[model samples]
Target: TEPLEKLMPIDGYEDMPLVPLDIAVEPLVSSISGIHIYAYSAKERCKNPPADDLTIDESASIMLYSMDSKFGNKSLHVILNEILKSADKNKLEPWLLYLKLFLTALSHLPSTRRQVYRGIKLDLSKEYPVGETIVWPGFSSCTTSINFVQSELFLGSAGPRTIFSITCYLGKYIGNHSYYSSENETVIFPPTQFKVIDCLNQGNGLHIIQLQEIQPCFSHLHAPVFSSISKKPSSKLTFNSVVNHNTKWKQRGVTLTKHHSRGPKPDCLYLPYGVYVDDNQTIYIADHGNNRVMAWKYGATSGQLIAGGNGSGFNGSGCETNQLNKPINVVVDRRRNHVFISDSGNMRVVRWPCENGTNGEVII
Candidate 1:
């Protein structure tokens, strides 16, 4: 070992007091039953366990019970009232409880509405299994897949909230061969149906599930939306007439992409590749050909050069913050108040302290 006095400090290291092993082990030992250890990775939040995988029904039931457990009742109104009281008292439980409620709401439509609740399970652990059984209350063996949507842990609140997405089959079954016929025509349907379930976990016993019926389209999951057309009723038009109507649009096609003049000036942008806009309506553009990143404010005529605008060249790439070699993308971290750049040509990613800061530190 080298002399302690001669040792240089690391880039992100500092001395701190040592922690006692007993003190660290106290919480782990105290909550062993509730502590279902998950192998957390940088790539995933809450990965499913290999053995004894929890079903959608089990997840939803756990979520509902967790809500009831928190508020001591199943009534949402009472829960909301408790949350409001806690919030008024400046307590954190209400915020956490409300978040769980929000997560539960996203699981499915509320019980107040007219919904067809086919299967209901009081005991989730005994009722739900991994395969060939009822995965959720109204869903069963047809569960095709379970996907992870998003998971987040909020500070100033009690616990972490994790949400999962699941897809299952909801097949249609006919008891007899009798078919109902309409006045105009008879409609025959396939025997299989599918639905999507959104499951939320409060990192405790409470779990909530929201379910939505998946409709059959042209093999596409998401339905297309048209802004100009109304869903209720519309007038019919010929194919040629509709084509001609669309061609007569009088709006400016390109806004920011259009340039006032064509040159590598302070105002003129060249071969703009990646663009990102922050919450403040500030646009960060990676002008690849110019080898620079420009920060343009909303409605501004010209942008101020943020990084590497000193005449494009791979030779200009260096460890210096001002130097960038053909940047490809830019992202602004609003929380950290920093702008990150993908300096592709330099083969390294860099980030600036602020929007107008001079020097940037290489990150990746």
Candidate 2:
């Protein structure tokens, strides 16, 4: 069978209207033997997806593929991908119904934008040269864990391993719905292409290949339907919780701010009114009684005064641009790189630089 690399076009699958799970994959049952049983079971397991755009049936159809079933050596995924890679268009007829429904479901899944990992038990470094584009023309299975590929359960430690570090922007994160939910699997659909960044041999049989997912000149699959309402059902596992272990899922947390514990002074929270956390985990708080906005970076004890801190000249009055009068709210304009302070006591809103500004300008 020809490989499905470089956006290999399988005819007629994309145009077929999506059908229900029980019937859409029925054509495959004749060829695959026991797929009907798996389809029924997969539907039962995926009655409700973590997102809303796809129907229960569409989600279940996808879950069937996402199951990564293996029986008597050949899995459903392996067979499906093999035929997709074939240059002959006639082989795609039996798969049309299932492919349409499957692709439709994948289109509803919100694209996960981050680095994902996959490993192969070969030295395929020569295949992917730096500055070249490679395509995986099937539902490409990848995991987000670096540890999984290295573990004894997977590729193992002592073997020829080619670790693909992929920066994917259109991959569907389906671990939450997959039967193997703990594996943190992300599926990259057909038309998935990558630009090889670099490939290096890390001695002893290990090779690391870096690839970045690139968009084709035209889209092969339909546009995503769930891009606007991206919030998943309450059960979806977030990327943060997937990577790092959570302790209070252990039920204990140490204090973060400890410079001046409790008082109406600098770095102290005297009825702190508003708090905003940035992408860098910088905490901006409007210290109500202290008349100041404090910025605390991650793992910092003492906070730096960013918006307003009243010293000798504007202690009570707080009319100085360098000070505030009962700052009750604080928000940061990340694009402008400035903090907007609500000077409640002075009845004005002030905008100040969040980093090292000693003065503020009243905006409203």
Candidate 1 — what's its lDDT?
0.37
Model 2 spans with C-alpha error above 4 angstroms: 1-8, 47-53, 218-364
Clashes of 1: 10
Report the number of the highest-TM-score candidate: 2
Candidate 2 lDDT, 1-364, residue by residue in tens: 2142565455676555444465567567667888878988987787454344556556676678876677457888788777767676677798887877677677667797988988888888888889988777767888999898778888787778898999999998877667787789888977788899999898878899999999875544554323211133221111111112221222674454444333445545643556677777776877655678888777777777787665423323546777787565677888999988867667578899978798999798
Candidate 1 accuracy as TM-score? 0.30
lDDT of residue 2 for candidate 1: 6
- Among these predicted structures, which one has the highest lDDT? 2
- Taking all chains together, each candidate's TM-score versus the true structure is 0.30, 0.58
RMSD of 1: 22.7
Task: Give candidate 1's error at residue 215 in angstroms.
Answer: 30
Alpha carbon deviation, residue 345, candidate 1 (Å): 0.8
